[model samples]
Target: MRHRSSASANRLPAPRKRFGQHFLTDTRVLDSIVEALGDLSGTTVVEIGPGRGALTDRLVARAARVVAIEVDRDLVQHLRARYADRPNVEIVEADVLTTTLADLAGGPYVLAGNVPYYITTPIIFHALELPRPERAVYLVQKEVAERMAAPPGDKTYGALSVNLQAVVNVEFLRKVLPGAFNPPPAVDSAVVRITPKAEAAIEPELEERYRSFVLAAFGLRRKQLVRVIRTVASLDAERALDVVTRCGLDPMARPETLTPVEFARLVRALYAAPSSR
Candidate 1:
């Protein structure tokens, strides 16, 4: 019910480099992002880094309720004033990294954002760590998008790819060019949709172990799996190879070559083996 007035009147705040602010001004790309969300008529939408309320306006037009969380104080004031009359929109001044998703929306909701490039992964991880949302859409750096949706053995495959794949079905929606933003970013960006798989369930303890093992393996990515595992899991070469064999993986495989499931299997094997005790 509210609208962004002419910038000449309010004199919009400058995009801060520290906040990684890049205001999306392209109408076509904005429409595509909203369409990608697909029918959010009655769902609460949590938007992170709604710089100058460009994406926020579109979200408000469709979402049942829009909770716009802005970390930058300047933009927060602009959004609050812009949406002051819109009862459906709540402008929350908070850091997305520190704020819990549960605190923002009570029931079923979708998470959307033109996330800061530097903190994109943390934001996605935070959302996924919460009780799963219906879906999450982010306009992140193209490189990050590719990595999040990367398959095993792909050049971009690493810890992010594996950890995200272990829980969500990641889809790279579309490529957004740099010209789309007011002060365009040097690198291009892409929209990504992350949906939690219904059956992708991992217990808390196992999930922790899975994260630890995956991170350690990727930390020594250039090394063979056997040696990396030996160092990370504190196992000798024989024990490391044993875990790899139990997981149906080859001793010569590198960390980046293994799929998320493979990592989980290897972690579980190591945890259950007698030598791990």
Candidate 2:
């Protein structure tokens, strides 16, 4: 079905609850988001969930090409019609989670999105996968942004923090309140910029193991490092203490206090340590 232009008719499709749609309507915030993306002159941007095309309008102006992925059929049709005349903008009708950035962009690209709140973490991790985007700017829930950019020893620091920080430099740009959207979300939102590190703390080959190790550590977060290593590495108490101490981590220190580098160090140590199970 051909969707009418929201702009021409002064009507927009109702925000679908199933898709977790909250159209960002604040023009100031919109300008700030596009500005945060830096120069896109010759860049290809993969925009996730381009609801109502507010950000898309700004992105298309600066970006050489934009592949806007929308899961909602109605929004997809609307976007397709909206950008029909523009050869540079390609509206992809697919779930961002199911489609990889490499597949969509075909090469180096920047990612921008006001993603669904429920799937924000998954989307972030997806973007961080192999053949990663050059840079990514996301409008995510404020607390999730804090968790992403949280430092070691912070209350919000955990598996997500360590996992993302190990590979990328996370910057919490600004906080956005609920009123900025067409239908205000219950919680506040924030913008974050993520740039891949030239030298990641953990090697690509070790990323899966690193993620698993970090998850195990935070699963038993309240416990000491010695205990976490013992359980996750299937080592004896003495061996676990040896490995923890060898990593220069205090045997008594909790997982939440360890930095991404420390965690990567511990992962290497544990991988090298023979199991005593």
Candidate 1, residues 1-277, lDDT tens digits: the string is 3475445326588999999889999999888888878899998998888888888889998989999899888888888778776899998889988888866887778888999988888888888865777888899999999999999889999899988888889999999999999789999999999898776634445776787778888999999989988999899888888878877988998998887877877877776445432
Give the Å error, residue 151, model 2: 0.8
Instruction: Report the error of model 1 at residue 261, Å.
Output: 0.7
* Residue lDDT tens for model 2, 1-277: 2233446423568998898999999999999989988999999999999987999999998999999999898887778777777889899888888898888898999999998999999899989888999999999999999999999999999999999999999999999999999899999999999999999988787888899899989999999888888899999999998888788889999999999999989887766335421
lDDT of 2 at 115: 85
Q: lDDT of each prediction vs. the true structure?
A: 0.85, 0.90
- TM-score against truth, every candidate: 0.92, 0.94
How big is the positional error of residue 174 in model 1, measured in Å on the Cα after superposition? 1.1
Which ranges of candidate 2 are over 4 A from the true structure? 1-10, 272-277
- Cα deviation in Å at residue 256, candidate 1? 1.5
Q: How close to the true structure is residue 155 of candidate 1, measured as C-alpha lDDT? A: 93
RMSD of model 2 against the true structure: 3.4
